[model samples]
Target: MILVGAVVVLLCWLLGFWLLWHIPAPGEFRRRAGRAPAALAVPESIPLSVSVVIPARNEERNLPCLLQSLAEQTRKPDEVIVVDDHSEDATAAVAARLGARVVRAPDLPSGWMGKPWACWVGANAATGSLLVFLDADTTLSPEGLENLVAEYRVQGGMLSVQPYHVTLRAYEQVAAGLNITLMMGMNVFTPLGDRLAPSGAFGPCVVCSRADYFATGGHKAVRSAILEDSFLGRVFA
Candidate 1:
């Protein structure tokens, strides 16, 4: 009994430490790629037309903050599409109130899960050169779009970033930290930096060129996947 308890404690400690260690890499990438700033010189003469797509399901509590943040972007998205994924609450109403074009999600197709299906629905309705898949819980800085556009322009491929999560619970923080660390330990950015085929990055902040999105078959290819974002990343690679 003593040995089993000791082993369990040790495993928990190691896991906690590992997660905390990786928390900074996403922040580092955000800073290095220019998305962390509040102000940037976004060219008005050549503004990139971006479609920001948000997948929402009973997200009334989180939608307001995200919508306000989007409204404040330094380089505004040309259009915003919010897919209401069978929400029982005011997800559709709130989104429409915030000036986003709200699309009602149809029946969950046979293979696709909730979020990715919503993303696909929104993507089909989008009309922009750039497609940004943003989560309902994500809050972006004013210069967020500028940095994402810059990253896409420089790489000439897809761009994804790890967003800073606001966690009220200790376990949530630990999860965020650990997830970040795993990505860093895997050296996710180095290959992306050198233009090697982009691998699975986070889905929360995925941005891809519209042409590339279509070329890669968009979310249709990964409709049945539980890890649709990662699957899309592999396909992009």
Candidate 2:
């Protein structure tokens, strides 16, 4: 019985691998060709004004790292807006010290989730052509912003990135496998990712044109959703 179970598991793994391999690769699946800010040859004619929005609640510890990283971006955003979502900690102070424009998130209204409401507030305050929504815990590489802009110009739609897990604790390392499985289960790497169904979006980082974002009603459309990021992706699709 043990041997039979082992064989079944191995076969299942193989089948899963085969399915993943056979799926059509989306445009966003391309390798990181531009590794530095200078490497991204954005056309001078195309005016790309990016506004980065971060929604934080009691994220004082994590907010600093993200803000510092953003400061180091090769292709710097025109502005960074950090929405303080009623944080009990020094999240607002940290963001302000880092030179980010801090905005207070209004009291959560009925039928609105915290994160989405904060994001919506930030989006409304943003004045850039492109909006880059990033979580407080996310740290970007110096070239990350440049690469994102390059990719967006090529893909011409919403772009969501599933960050590479950098884990220190053993439990976190173990959880990484589950995270990958969840992403794969949603068909994130397949062509279906471009559609509404059987698709996924990573909430940690998302970039899209301001026009497209508002066209889909932004987070306001998914105000009550528990999985606002995933639902927002579907709305964009």
**Best candidate, TM-score-wise?**
2
* Root-mean-square deviation of Cα positions for candidate 1 versus the true structure, in angstroms: 5.6
Q: How many collisions between residues are there in candidate 1?
A: 2
lDDT assessment of candidate 1: 0.79
- Give per-residue CA lDDT, model 2, range 22-115, as digits (tens): 3434332443323343333344467889999999999999988999999899999899999999999899988999899999998999999999
lDDT tens readout by residue for model 1, 140-224: 9999887788766545567777787778987787786666654654344443443344457688889987888888888888888
Residue 225 in model 2: lDDT? 92
**What are the runs in model 1 whose C-alpha is more than 4 Å off?**
1-47, 184-197
Q: Among all windows of ten consecutive residues in candidate 1, which has the lowest summed lDDT?
A: 18-27
Clash totals for all models, in order?
A: 2, 0
Model 2, global lDDT = 0.83
Clashing pairs in 2: none
State each model's C-alpha RMSD to the native.
Answer: 5.6, 4.3
